[model samples]
Target: MAKKYVDINTLKYLLYDVYQLEEVLNQDRCEDHDISSMNLILDSVKDFSDRELYPYLKEMDEQPAHYKDGGVEVHKQVGVMMKQGGEMGFISGPFDYEEGGLQLPMMLYTASSFIQEAANNHLTGYIGLTLGAAELIINFGSQELKDIYVPKMLSGDWGGTMCLTEPQAGSSLSDITTKAIPQSDGSYKISGQKIFISGGDHQYADNIVHLVLARIEGAPAGTKGISLFVVPKKRPDEEGNLVSNDVTTVADFQKMGQRGYCTTHLGFGDAGECQGFLVGEANKGLKYMFLMMNGARIAVGRGGAAIATAAYHASLEYAKERPQGRKLASTGKKDPEEGQTFIINHPDVRRMLLFQKTVSEGSLGLVLLASKYYDLKHTLTDEKEKEKYGLLLELIIPMVKTYPSEMGAQSVSNGLQVLGGYGFCTDFILQQYHRDIRIFSIYEGTTGIQSQDLLGRKLLLENGKALQLLTEEIKQTINSALKYDDLKKYAGKLGDKLQEASKVIQHLIGFAKKGDYERFLSDATPFMEYLSTITLSWIWLEMAVNAKNALVTGKKTYSEEFYESKIHAMKFYFKYELPKTNGLAEVLLNEEVLTIAGEKEVFN
Candidate 1:
């Protein structure tokens, strides 16, 4: 078992030092929480993860979940995870205390989630999906619906999922053909097929509740007519007896990685007996589902970052323990008297490790920033304050989802490279991590989807007010960076990049203004890459400034080495990662527009 996957210190540092999560806790919505209580929550989660999760990661992966006898079977520990997680309020942490929750901040829940995700990525989703589904119920479900489903779902006796994608429609939700017919008793008969439903069917839970999206009969076409339904594998009869709901587990998807997570093909109302209860009102299903999207996307990114963290640590451990080469002298001659040096001592290995460090830890910072924004947006009383944080959150949601996913893949790949041949073999964890992380970019939304949302929608959010707020925020960080002599040059470099960003955005917006959306959105993925790179640079700089302040202020909360490592990583990110934005901007600015459909086809 890989013992060290995530660094808890990094999570705390981002939450307390860089972001000052206490600011949110002091707000009216979360005033009950404090730093000490939150720390204990994190500490307890980490301890639970160490005992129940970390040890079985490999075992779960080796014994992949399988489908047989009308249900999907997974590693038995999945039950333990859901049950214990609920008992400890991990699922209900972010909900209101009146709703039987601990009412913890989302960032703290995010921190707890990262620890478990790093410990066992495949198994953690069962709990995550349950949390997402349960939250949706708490927010939108009718009182009776809540009375029947909320308690069991949150208690871990019943798992929950958002059934969105279908085999025919995939990411295109408008094309889904699922149908829900209204019945006399305020229930609907749902008939549809949903594919790639994670935690779709599991034997451990007594029942699974699916928040399914289906169109009511005689409603308008496309997403406008869609409605959200609370569909369960087993429903209570008029006498309150549990009976099968005819929600069939069609098959299990055997994937190259994350094998323990049971992704299934589902057939609803196969025998025309599936009953579903409406959530909120009809035709607002898409909106209700979208309300949960930002949080879900952030969780997906966190999963990617956590996997990369685990993979990096696994590779780092291998590099430190498996020494094979001798160190060369300044004259480029091997020292015969000096024995073989650990690969970690080699500059190239260290470079790869540092790259992983910058990507994983920095990605963590970005996600927490998004979550903090979420906290403030919902918690703040002033309308202007809420609007500001909400827009900022809107502007960065795409990057928050894409950067960790798209870059975390590269980070995990580097981790594999660090392990050399062992990285490719099943004997090491990197190979599985390499496979596990490939799906993140595709999850929640693909990178292309995120990029388009960024360029077409998010960039223009609230008539560009969001981007302006982002610029102002970045400028604040730059101003802080300017205070230190060592960081002044990097700060200036960032200022130039911000100007360049303005120029590039103007150049693209000009295309959009002229009704050339084809060209405007052609290089969106590259723009996403560019903007995500710049965003991470901003975060690293902020972290560096905080670390420097700690050291200079004589606040020895962490050791000098701890603070210095972030400083070094910040510098490393600026040198290595930020420069790529220039090339991406070049691609975004070029008017040639090769990728858009042209007069003639280029590919065979």
Candidate 2:
């Protein structure tokens, strides 16, 4: 199989034609960039991935990251990606010029990241966590703290990780017991154990900085008491010398997949000497950490998208070349005497390939759409436009973070199936793709957590105005798609989904209105899948209409095959994938209360 991890043409189409990257580039924040400049960076990153990422993926996975000599030893490529990524501005692309960044649009940076992830997801985490942690410090840390931490992180001389999960708390962050005792010098003595910390402790960088969530001494209970801290593995001394802050790598967690990305159990203040500096105001830590979590959520979705894409191309290449069986005729007759035919000639194989394409491409589009909203939320000049974009971003975050993750995982599984038994074998990368993507749905937030968040909070955000804004946007797409005769049915189908979603939401809201919040959110997961299906349908329809218009106007950026392919995938999604909502909605509207804990024990 070819080393075709990502389709640059498809990425370009989504960014340039579908999402309109120029609209973002025209903004004051990105005025210095255009498509040509963006393409140059994309090409560079692709080349770098080819050289530094793809070939080494299996080797790293086989070797894996392990604890050695009190530090985690990752593949040497980890160091290469960090230094080269920092030199190429991958770590600081979206920061301002003065912040030692390229000052580029987030959309472009994310697109490049998709390529890197598809090539080697395990390696991508090293730099991604650094960038996210540094961004938190830049946004919320004091000037002195920023001066101390952000530059080194961005330069790849240091690494960063967010310490949130504990052995007992799991996802219930409110129950975290990490403590921060204030000192006379304004620094705090931090003590806690954070498990499942990715890129937590590695020998690839000189030092590691942790953005920790801890509670101050004598503060309120629960989330209200939490505060953010910049706790480094080695806090700097008065003469800028690096010394131990008593942060210890207690153990590295071995995983079933993403073998090269180290997840460690960290113990802070074992010697009662862990120094932590406060970030922003006290008790607003959750709020600030959420800012990075949202970004990490989208990144996780992109990880899913990238893995699915790589698997699709791998399976596709195999299908086109690997000959095994003969295809049946239109009359449903097969001749055993005939020579073997390529799997691509078989309808079933084509079906599997199309499913992979549909989920992978659509996932990329959904994530890019969210990134566009993010760029607009920050860059737009008008307050109203910024606010509108912000609301839209908030509303679709659950879907943007989840559809690609959950659906993309299923898509990769199907890709594995396409290769028959070889997909699960080490001869192919499909098995690794499957393992690497399984974590996204569980990372940042689980699918259930994201679902409950969407149906419970975002729908009611801003007095329900956030959902209203999304409705208007979807309707606008439907209205534009109505111009083409071929798209009318899809347009109508999408409009019906909107109505179905509205009805389902209203029915769920009734339970909320009656003060039965448990019943209101009982079916939140199904409702989330329902809403995500509708959103993906809307996304596909919008892209198909763009392709149709391009073909009609003869203003093709890609080949006619590409445009026609979009139309075919749109039809496939409508015919095969969209109807899934009917079953999900059925589950949502049945009013069955079997899920919530009841007065009597149900399960045996």
lDDT of the candidates, in the order given: 0.91, 0.92
Task: Please write out the lDDT profile of model 1 over residues 1-604, one tens digit for every residue.
Answer: 4669888888899999999999989998788788999988889988998999988888888999999998899999999988998899878788888777877888888889999999999888998898889888889998888889888888888999999999889999988899999999889999999999999998889989999999999888999998999999999888988899989999999998899999999999999999999999899899999999999999998898899889888888888898888988989999888889999999999999999999999899999999999999988999999999999999999999999999999999999999899888889889889999999999888999999999999999888999999999999999999999999988998999999999999999998999989888888899999999999999999999999899899896788999999999999999889999888888878878677777899999
TM-score of each candidate structure, all chains considered together: 0.99, 0.99
Which residue pairs in candidate 2 have backbone atoms (N, alpha carbon, C) closer than 3 angstroms, thus clashing?
none
Candidate 2 lDDT over 1-604, as tens digits, reads 3558899999999999999999999998888888899999999999999999998988988999998888898999999988988888889888998878888887998899999999989999999999999999999999999999999999999999999999999999999999999999999999999999999988889999999999999889999999999999999999999999999999998998999999999999999999999999999999999987668888988999999999899999989889997878767898899899999988888999999999999999999999999999999989999999999999999998899899999999999999999998987888988898899999888999999999999989999999999999889999989999989999999999888888888999999999999999988888888999889998999899899999999999899999999999999999999999999888888966888887999889
Best by lDDT: 2
lDDT, candidate 2, at 516 = 97
**Decoy 2 TM-score against native:** 0.99
Q: In model 1, where do residues sit more than 4 Å from their true spots?
A: none
- Scored by lDDT, model 2 comes in at 0.92
